[model samples]
Target chain A: MQSDNPTAAILVIGDEILSGRTREGNAHHLAQVLNATGFDLREIRVVSDDQDQIVAAVRALDGSLGGAFDLLFTSGGIGPTHDDITADAVAAAHGTTVVVDAGARALLQARCDRMGLELTPNRLRMARIPVGATLIDNAVSAAPGFSIGQTHVMAGVPEVFRGMVDWLIPKLPGGRPVQSLSVEVRRGESDVAEPLAELAREFSDLSLGSYPFHDERGWGTNLVVRGLDAARVAEAMHAVKQRLAL
Target chain B: MQSDNPTAAILVIGDEILSGRTREGNAHHLAQVLNATGFDLREIRVVSDDQDQIVAAVRALDGSLGGAFDLLFTSGGIGPTHDDITADAVAAAHGTTVVVDAGARALLQARCDRMGLELTPNRLRMARIPVGATLIDNAVSAAPGFSIGQTHVMAGVPEVFRGMVDWLIPKLPGGRPVQSLSVEVRRGESDVAEPLAELAREFSDLSLGSYPFHDERGWGTNLVVRGLDAARVAEAMHAVKQRLAL
Candidate 1:
């Protein structure tokens, strides 16, 4: 479906996720947030913590090679550890260098002082930012995320990622909020596929999706209609209900 | 760390996931299974149910453009609905055509007869397979998944996807299963970063990662050591614990 909404993609960088040690939550959280803010999320990619992989993914998503997204959000590999290489990878992708941002360093220094912890060089790694980037606020932790080019790099922790997204979404350029409505039918998806396809063709501007689920009540399909226009979304949902004789 | 294990990539095809309507579980499940079965999962990608995107991802993951994986597993978009276009996309990616397989048709026919349901055209869509592909058994449902080239296409349902993986993993070639050990230290990640980096450099064959978490007990780091050799992994973990004084 074509959308006037700005497009976005999420790049999740971590070995813990690739090894199945950590279930991914940041991408899903950002997806919902971006959807509500009316950005068309086109893709979500999970790559290892390897710098080359991170650079390739960031460049690909940022549209350096082809169709580019208006915004790219990355999670993971921004921690105060040896494996935290996102800042360097993102800088490499942008053809820039990583530098210590005074604002980020001050925040880290203040946080260390408040917690009675030494601001060691390892902890200072979090202060590094790509050149020509602005710091993104992190209310939970003082180590701020940063916006470099079209990409916003954030921490992988679920709480910190959510806080970064919450703090950053309001400042982004957004279109009209997307309106989504759904109707649950007890019939099989194939039983309604023909009519649903017809409805989808009729409302080409809206996105209609059929998701199957099985519960104690038995098999069912959730028919969802989403669009930037509230009335159009509601009208399409009503048609779905009527066509299915709900 | 370099290994002899066959590399693999997972492509998740669905708008539901990109829209945040469904939390991704299949990729994580597949990762753990592949890890245990001795496959190196290099990447996991989630793209909307767009034919062009699916074809491009399939080509890229299959290494038609560059470095190829030994196997590519795709989940979702195989249902009996209009949006279920994975089979067609995969066929196009291979420069082939989608045709109904006799074995698949027989399975679907038996399922319909047993369930006392009509074998409608939409239902028959599940029987269509890419030419020159073999069926991957799905114990949960009669609708069989297919493996074309190095790519195995499976259902989106968690139960069915797991069943397909169980049936397919043993049939594929694998190397030594990866051995992983972890030590949870009550110290912050920055406090342990320097020693961990030294250990990582010392044991260049093993992967050492430090993941930080915060709970009621306060902040701590989980030092994970992973490698193909059990002895090496154990040795790395020992070094990490000793270095961190855990």
Candidate 2:
């Protein structure tokens, strides 16, 4: 199912997330957006803001570890605070240096001027971009994200991350969009496991997933079939309904 | 900061999460539980329900990839459906085989009898356990999670996962519980970055993190101090507030 589609991964760098001080939202949002845009999101990893960890994750997700991804979207650690070390870590991973980009600095200066705030040295830290990287526009905040190699570094704040993703996704290459069909049945997953397995074997090219839900009424399963081919996905959905006798 | 605490990682195995069909809650719940239990939650990885991916993540989180962890907790992929291949994957990662444990089968049988459902082969799939693994009790559901070596695998359902965690945390060895103090200031993170960095440098032993938030009112920053020593954490918080004039 993934062989034909371009694969992507997410690297969420934040101690607040790891400490459970903040609930991770950017990864989930990216997952949905990538899925809709025809990218297969293979993995999502959350690591602390530690430089070594961030660098290792960047390399690992960028294909130095094992399986490689076509794109790696990183969230968090792109702010002005001392803990925002994503730019430097990404630069180290790509064997480059962090430098202040003229465009980014101008944008920060303009934002500060508009807000009636000083463009202090601390705020200037947000202008640091990885060498040889293209600036990713952030409409919400002036401090722009950047893309060095296949990795796209974004801010940790949800609004800024969404804005960056919106600005970045349209520029990247996409694959055939996948169509999904879901059938909800109020039955235990075990009761339908055999038939679902048979259907999965029959439709090997499609991704078949069984998600169980429990509510006050009873147990139920949401069987979903996803494929790049719309006709095949529909055919598989019909077969699933028939096989499950729903 | 991590040297004194037992480091733990979470491996979430579910295509639903990666495909954006479901929001990931187990990892966040486990993160808070592990944090409160004094285990340093180092990393969290979300992978699809593919067997190879699950095996790779289990090994990676268990220290075969790069950095090793003291504990690894896995969520999802232990259901009766065909996609539930976590037991087999974990066994393969450990170079073992999945076998139906007698105790687990009995538990499944009792649950089936109570629900007045047939214990078919598909239903019996839930009894499969990794070799040499001890069953982790699941009070919400009949099927039990299991622990092999340092890896403890649990359910994906939030209620079941929480129950299993409640039953499992007390059994694991814990380190000094971390104390965290937060000082919220109605200022942008960049406005306080300099003082925060100074405070962080002064309290090098403690972990200081600045999290920026944006709401309808305006921007605000939460400066958090976390350390094993409660007094040190409090002192760092005080210095952070004083230096920032919060």
Off by over 4 Å in 1: A64-67, B64-67
Q: After superposition, how far is residue A208 of candidate 2 from its true place, in Å?
A: 1.4
How does candidate 2 score on lDDT?
Answer: 0.89
Weakest 10 consecutive residues of candidate 2 chain B by summed lDDT: B59-68
Q: Which lDDT tens digits does candidate 1 get at residues A1-246? A: 658988899999999988988999899988899889889998999999899989888888986435357789999888888789999999999989999899999999999999898888999999999999999996787888999888999998777888899999999999877789988889878899999999999999999999987667767889999888888899999899999899
* Cα-based TM-score, every candidate: 0.97, 0.97
Name the candidate that leads on lDDT.
Answer: 1
Q: Which lDDT tens digits does candidate 1 get at residues B172-194? A: 99988889999888977888899
Which DockQ values do the candidates obtain, in the order shown? Answer: 0.80, 0.85
Q: Highest DockQ, which number?
A: 2
lDDT by residue (tens digit), candidate 2, B193-213 = 888888878888989998998
